[model samples]
Target: MASRPGAWRNILRRQPSSPRKTSTISHISLPLEIPVEEETLPYYEPEHYYPVHIGEVYESRYQITGKLGYGAYSTSWLCRDLQVLKVSTSLPKFPTATDREPKIYGHIAKINSTHPGQALIREFYDSFDLQGTDGRHRCLVMQPMHMSLLEMMGLNPRPFDLPLLKMTVTRLLIALDFLHAEAGVIHADLKTDNQKSTAPPPKQIDESRIIYKSRKFGRPDKAKGYGLPSLCDLGESRIGATQESNPFVQPHIYRAPEVMLDMPWGSAADIRNLAGLIWDLFEGEHLFGAVFDARGGHDPFKHFALIVALIGEPPSEFVKRSETTGQCFDTNGNWVAHEDEVIPTVSLDNLEKRLFGQEKQLFIQFMRSMLKWMPEERKTAGQLLEDPWLQ
Candidate 1:
């Protein structure tokens, strides 16, 4: 049969049959027509990424099958584990913060928990050091996963169904509870990219670059047995209980008030982060979109102005904790960034769509619990699990 117009070009590669003999048994696919640029190919360098070849066996068990995805730090490959007869993800290594991730995962592993959310967190299966052209690359083995929530949101144009939203929130809260109470950890970054739903086999491989088409998961129906959303990528996670200083963490738009004002932040920051994520996912808009200055740089004062518009001004005591609070708020706790001009006349009550009356009330109340000016004022993950809105 003639090959399809845009189908993958397949080639049989030689694989080692034994210690001495080799066999042309493994098939490798490369895209028939390469695009002007593949996803992370432009950023690929010998020093940064380990050169992965198709049909190559690592640790004498994982056979590189295809490309999965890539971020700024690492590129993931789909591999068939010969010994276990299961598919797994092989992260060659991230150049930055290579040592920190293993330590964080180690801390998470030590906490023995039967909490339902414990299973939802993605942890590395195995790790080893691989010598590459640049240096030793820290390779991580993880379970094969689906595309991320961000990708799913992009693919599906319509609004998220309420049922799916509720279910996702419930699961996320459970996971957060486990991390906070059981693990004494905080997933400081809780964006959609870290949360994944589901992967396809690889399409092609160059000598150094692997080319694969990314797949999009269709919008899930109100079906039972939807796999729990796994929270992956702990590179930015912090030891929650040990954070003594007010460190700048979290994505720009999702920054909690305390984090923005330079106050000591903890797990409550994650709660605020989750509220912002919920707004983005359900409302189809960012609660606090990135505000830029004249030079096209992030103007946090302008960003905080939007935050003030939605949830009233930061409490006086909250402002007192920060030396940098004067930049955004006055001594009287009023927004110093010209609230009349910069702050928009918006509220969560008015901005929220899809729900009405009591449902909206409950949701706004749910949001308020997390979006407080004071960190301690925010509800804990366990407390949020019992929220009527989620129920």
Candidate 2:
């Protein structure tokens, strides 16, 4: 298997292109037996480690292929369905965005899409509980996808083209639309890792490397399709009607103003995240970049300063609504001055001009609609779908 091996760590799944060297890695299927010694020289240890290994069975049904990833409280494993792949029975599904929303798995694929800017959700297959070394963990069996948007962007220095970014965001927005409208769910945590469309960049991948096994993990045949964008990792998702006293939680870059400011968030929170997500997808960076204070504090104030710098100041009324307003800003609606330096504010128009030398009015306007400090002022998923700039 090691054709000419040094250390077989990553599988280089190169995408073949026409005239240039543009390649993508959309899927990962690992062999049953991985031969690296667990005790191989290692200086680092992860905080949370699950005991899932190569060639294990779970729920007496799905065979564990490999570990997809792990989060603070959960682990995602690639499990092969022993039932075998059925073209007619599967009916092409979108894996539910996260393990929390078990019902939303097949719902996305069934929805009729008249909207122009949308992508399919990942298809879900099955789920069961597995007892790990820690405790009982939920194991979701779903269709496999390539690396996340964040992973893909990191693969290439150049940001994604406007068309591709817009298209992918549209698909994301539509997924939110379905979750909010059809399913009445709120994806409290929405970011690049949870959104999948483009595959990670691979090197020197060829046809010989392509393996076709009807019993293989994930949708192996889906390598060369149009690449449907889908939301993932729904462990944080909650039904809209279900009231939550949960604290602020989301990646620092995508954290909405209200969440940082200690305000009540709802479906609007997802919209706010979508704003940051869009900027990240296009510019390959967060609209509100992260920073540190003089005291090395990593709190809402520092995060909020980044927001103010990029999207302009929050409304005074919006500040009044926040319970933790005093934490980040003065009564004048100005961010508390840092002990070290003055934080500067930059509008999207200025950002566009600084980068592209001209104003992107439509793009700016579209972002403004979602970047509002007030959750109510932000566009709903349905409203975002109809935003002029999305087209």
Count of clashing residue pairs in every prediction: 4, 13
Q: Which stretches of candidate 1 lie over 4 Å from their true place?
A: 1-46, 82-96, 195-226, 242-248, 293-296, 339-341
CA lDDT scores, all candidates in order? 0.68, 0.55
lDDT of 2 by residue, 221-323 (tens): 5456336567766556776544344555666677766666656677887888888887777776667665555665455556666677766667788878755
RMSD of each: 8.9, 12.9
lDDT of 1 at 184: 85
lDDT value, residue 15 of candidate 2: 28
The residue ranges of model 2 lying beyond 4 angstroms of the native Cα positions read 1-49, 81-119, 194-226, 241-245, 293-297, 330-341, 353-359
> What's each prediction's TM-score?
0.79, 0.68
